[model samples]
Target: MRPDSAVSVPDMPAIDLQDVSKTYGSVVALDQVSLRVEAGEWLAVMGPSGSGKTTLVNLAGCLDTPSSGSVWVDGVDVSSFSRRELARFRAEKIGFIFQQFHLVPYLTALENILLAQYFHSLADAAEAMAALERVGMAHRARHLPGQLSGGEQQRVSIARALINDPAIILADEPTGNLDERNEEAVMELLRAAHQAGKTLVMVTHDPTIARYADRRIQLHHGRITDISIFSEDDEREFDQILSKLWTLRENHEPLHDDSLRIAGPLSVGRAIAAMTARGWLCRENGRITLLPPGEKRASDLIRRHRLTELLFSHTFELRNEAELEDQAFKFEHSLSPEATARICAFLGHPRACPHGSPIPQGDCCPAAS
Candidate 1:
């Protein structure tokens, strides 16, 4: 589409890439890849070091053009645009969050937000203040980037991103520089942004961060390896509870009043309340026991986890259980019944994980005994 005539379709995807590749010298940053992000969707990109997560984000944000493919943002082919056009398009359509605060050192938090609007057209003090207020940073609007804490600066960055009302937001390791408390606070704002109809693409090394997104994709050696779509809140919640139960069993531990610590960032009291309401857990003699249904659900989780550990070991030859642990957790949470069964058959239903943990026998596996 011509640059002037290009217009976004509310129902169509906000970002789309076809056969995209990015290379630098002899190193390939991203391989042939096609991806689409639906409007209003939150997508998380995850990978280890040098895995091309940032390369993908830079392409999506129009900071760099693909070496051998096409990229469309909001229905326009960005690579076709001139430098001026690309700058204008980004000003109008994209918002960015970075690991560093990247705020002007001398600018007040409120002025920093207005800076983004100034680039796009004209600054509105009312809108700038409102953006900061939305992120709970209004109280510190006059603080300089140097004067604000890391978390506070990040909040200002978020406000700046939203100030322009961009259709798409790309955040790279946004919380990597923050403490745990600040990480949660910033993530809550990102979630709020997603809920407000912005297409969000975030790249991070942390799985906990990925859960906030509606879907997550894993990149490895410049290629997409795994994608998990969390379409239902109930399903993710159930998976979380079941995974926690298996963890307690594996460690031969009993539940405590603070059992939610095992679930990571979840409220122990709230989880217990929900579990009680859902009949997933029952208290007996001060011990939490999974009901029969809960036990059955947790068994599947256990099986998937063991199988995933084996798969990673075989494919990557990980040196130890710790090395395979995160990959196993991600796979276990994302794998479907059908995919789990296929792995069960492919590994000939291994009787044990590398760590000597018994692999539960599923329908596709031979007898455990």
Candidate 2:
């Protein structure tokens, strides 16, 4: 049997990949990639589909082996590990969050977490329940994956991942399948994990989501292309607040503490305070109103939202109203002005959304069209 105990090394990087490549038949999945992730660092890997983002993650997490070079974790060359050893190493040292959640369909939330423990060590029901409680899913612990909502299932998946107290987390588009509200909730959980000093490596397509990491790297055709360090910013929070304000304006609702329902990581009061400080909005006579800059930003955001709705409804042929709305909400914050303009033009400068409401005119719309 392989060594049952993991040798601990002082001040070692959490993950290190040197000149690693992977090929499936004639197709090269990853091309000579080299990366190092420090302990407690949060790193974002981004690229388009088939760009080797997931492949790189799979190699680092020991879900797959590299075709060449070294794969090291906790200062040990995992490349030399047998399949069984790799499985044990993964259970002991890594936590994973995925877009699809991947919970056992027949298992209750609590049981799923316990299953993870069963693999690493002995199962403990109390510890499992506590893990669920941490993600606000303890009440749903008895429910099976099919009975839980998308967000709840993801919460359960997270609890299971963290139940082992793994040193590293590998999240592949963790929020991809979630709606805006759920996306925010899930991201908040990830932020908590990062703050607690877990080494995080996440694969995401959204720039806003990637900005959450300490640093982000771009991959292209299986090669590293660009790497950027994150700059602290409140742009995401501002966008969300502005989106909420725009909806209130559309519905002719007053912007008050009770009326405003801002979702995501930021609390309602904190979001409002930040907006007030940024001169995006103001409060007088116990009423809040958007300033010019705020108004412009909100209008643009609304335009993007409606455009996204159109893109889904008309282009993608999505028929479910709820799904369309959810997708539109998720995409609005990420769509670039250039892409929005191209979409507007592609749709023949449509004047109305699918719901018979006027789509706010973009600059790309022809005059008098």
Angstrom error of the Cα, residue 257, model 2: value is 41
In model 2, which regions exceed 4 Å deviation?
1-10, 233-369
lDDT of 1 by residue, 1-369 (tens): 114324457667889989999999999999998999998899999887898999999999988888898999998888667778888888888999999979999889988988888998888898889888988988999989999999999999998887777889999999999986799899989988898778999998765577688888888899998776644554566567666767777788885555545443445655555454444578766678887656766788788888999999998897676768987776677787779999989988888888888877888876656
User: Which candidate has the highest lDDT of all?
Assistant: 2
Q: Would you give me the overall lDDT of model 2?
A: 0.85
Runs of candidate 1 with Cα error greater than 4 angstroms are 1-8, 231-369
- Report residue 325 deviation for candidate 2 (angstroms): 32
On residues 1-369, what C-alpha lDDT tens digit does candidate 2 reach at each position? 114333446678999999999999999999999999998899999888999999999989998888898999977799878889899889988999999999999999999999999998989999899999999999999999999999999999998888888888999999999976688889899999999878999999776577689988889999998776623444666676787777777778887767766555667777676555444689887688998767767877778888889999987799999999998888776787778888889888888888876677877888882
Clashes of each: 0, 0
Candidate 2 lDDT for residue 256: 77
**What is the Å distance of residue 359 in model 2 from its true position?**
12
Error of 1 at 16 (Å): 0.4
Instruction: Give the Å shift of residue 313 in candidate 1.
Output: 42
